[model samples]
Target: MTKALTPGSIAPPFARYSHAVEIPAGHRLVVCSGQLGIDSQGDVPPDVEGQTRLCFANIAAILAEAGMDLSDIVRINAFVTGREHLPGYMKTRDEFTGSPPPASTLMIVSGFARPEFVVEIEVIASAP
Candidate 1:
């Protein structure tokens, strides 16, 4: 099992996710590249919520390719183009992971590689 950490000395995380995660011994790590909302046909979603959903879909596909799933995720890094998208991002994220949630960092960035892209997500997971 992955251990989610919330150290007593620090302020609690502002949202879902732990301060850190301690992967158990003997588990290997899976680090995924940043995923955008572009689909298999190469279309990017126009809206942040749609893009966020697609990002998770892409992540799930990568995890499946590695023989793992969301439960194995120990950490995530999310980048959004704007602040308004955060609520949707959090809702979609909570739907995917986190009984306790994985450690995460969310950032508001100026933009993405493509003008249409609204969000990007990357993750680090544990595998037995």
Candidate 2:
């Protein structure tokens, strides 16, 4: 199992995430590429919340392929087009993540490859 690391000496995380995670030495790691909001049908949601859901769904599928799941994720890096999307992104993220939520970083970027995409997410998962 992975251990969530949030030292008392440092400030607590701003959101539902740990500052770091300790993955056991024998675990296998899966690094997933960033996934945008588009689905198999190439449909992109216009709202940040909808798009954020799709991103996590895509990441879940990718982890499944590696014999892992969302709960196995140890770290998450997410990007949104603007600060306005922060609440939607964080809400959706909290819904998908498991207990002792993974260490995470959320950033605001100018844009994505496609203008319609409002969010993107990437994750690192580990399993024995």
Provide TM-scores for the models: 0.95, 0.98
Clashing pairs in 2: none
What's the CA error at residue 88 for candidate 2, in Å? 0.4
Cα RMSDs of all predictions?
A: 1.0, 0.6
Residue 39, model 1, lDDT:
93
* TM-score attained by model 1: 0.95
For residue 62, model 1's alpha carbon misses the true position, in angstroms, by 0.7
Clashing pairs in 1: 98-101
Candidate whose lDDT is highest: 2
Error of 1 at 98 (Å): 2.8
